[model samples]
Target: MLEKIKRRIEKHQAQPIGEQRTFAVFLPLVKVDEEWHVLYEVRSNHISQPGETSFPGGAVEEGESFEEAAVRETMEELNVSKESIEVYGEIDFIFNQSHHIRCFVGELKHINPDQLQPNEEVASVFTIPLRYLKENEPEYHTVTLKTEYNHDFPFELISNGKKYKFGKRKHKVPFYRLPNQFLWGFTADFTHRFIEIISEDTNFLEGKNEK
Candidate 1:
């Protein structure tokens, strides 16, 4: 079943598409223990997107394809060579107000936590069980604005923060919870969607009694 998914992704990658956009690859390290685990990273405070939790990936450079960028970023960030990764497939593409995200999934045959190079853009690295994410229910909230258009945004979860209210109007600064990780903004959205797709596939295969 994983092979089938991989073939479909390769076909998509091979097709030529115009209007190329900035793409990123997210390598989700899955551990096969009593339960499945997925790796995550905390962004370094020095970076613009600081304290944010995300997978190891960045913008695709000029003349670089999505796969190349993914492989390169993974090697640089995790210090894990390309040969150690077994590309499985890709997750759904997530588009934010700022950028378009192209995500891919690969397996790590071996991992040495000590060898991980968390640069100025990355603070720390960690892993959490997949079941924790699958069971958590997210709460979405919105805020209205008096801009060109009245916009209401959705925030998955909230933390202990200030909630401001106007005359019949209110805005809440919320923080999203990802079990052991905290996710927000584009990275959060991308990871959430990726997990949803993988979980669905796993469930479908389980129902069919396929290994």
Candidate 2:
């Protein structure tokens, strides 16, 4: 199944797409009980956005492709070798009010969770069942915030068993969650959309098989 997904993804890469600002998020996978688990990272406190649960990824660098940046960032952040990860299909493109993000799923044949290097920007690594995300209603919260260009917009955050409230300042506004790991901002939005796409695809395949 993983190999099939990989082939599907590779086929999509051949098509030319419009030029737009894009970033990549990696959905790392591991197998357990013949099912897949998705890996996520808890951002370290030393970083600007501390304690946020996010995929190991970042902005695409100048002169670098999105796939290159995804693979590079994942390797750097998780200490996972590039050779071991198999590229699966991409998630839908998320258009943030500020920028756009492209997400990809990748499979890791052998993952050493204990060897995950906590970079100054990454506190820890964690995994949750892909099936859980497919089935559950993720909690959401409202956040109002100003962009870097000084524009205010209403934002949303997906709560991961964390408490949060809305707060504002003269220049900035945010949804302040209790000082623990909560998935919010672009990361949360990307994650939610990714799961939605995967669920739809899985259902479609199931229906086809039933026929």
Candidate 3:
């Protein structure tokens, strides 16, 4: 298995660049009554990003590849066997300043949501139909993050006792509203792009599945 994975990596010619805080997520899709749906997890209140909806995943650990991390995290959180997951391929990489996320898509085989056990990091599991995402557009909201500095004596040496301009950073946040549920932030960003890619490749807007 390791040899096969090594060949696949070599085929893609992928390499890690520098030292980055990396994360990986699996976009698990399942068939529900002839329609494809995307699964999501609501983070536990005790964990980071509490109550936020995201795909099953976690940080990439030492000696583990991005794909390995994705599978491991999904298994740990959802308590599903690795054999049940069929990883298709990576969709895209999301870069947010210093860190980045490796996004992958896959199908979960014979999954019973009611029977699945969630760990402490997961509050509940839910699904969003692919048709909904392909049809509806996310609400775009922009905000600027201003830099804050402490009052210290070092400002005089750098700016010659004059006030220096510190620029603010702007970001466009995506929000997808589905019934009573709302998906925003990095989760929404990845999902939005995934929908676009599949839509274009498969003519999803015309109600066709990917070949």
Q: Largest TM-score belongs to which candidate? A: 3
| Native-to-model Cα distance after best TM-score fit, residue 185 in candidate 3, in Å | 0.5
| Candidate 3, 34-150: lDDT as tens digits | 778999999999899898899999899989999999999999999999999899999888875567899899988899775779899999988888988888879999999997777
Model 2, span 1-211: residue lDDT tens: 9999998998885633556566787878876555667777988888767767888888899898777888888888877788977887787677634557878887876776656675677888877666666555456655555323223433334453133343453322222132354655566566567667766776633533221
Candidate 3 clashing pairs?
none
lDDT of each: 0.67, 0.68, 0.87
Ranking the candidates on lDDT from highest down gives 3, 2, 1
Q: Pick the candidate with the highest lDDT.
A: 3
lDDT of 3 at 44: 95
**Candidate 1 per-residue lDDT over residues 24-88, each given as its tens digit:** 87656656553455677887888767877778888899889887888788777777778877778
Span of 10 residues, lowest total lDDT, candidate 3: 153-162
Task: Please give the clash total of every predicted structure, in order.
Answer: 0, 0, 0
- Which of 2 and 3 is the better model by lDDT? 3
Worst 10 residues of 2 by lDDT: 169-178
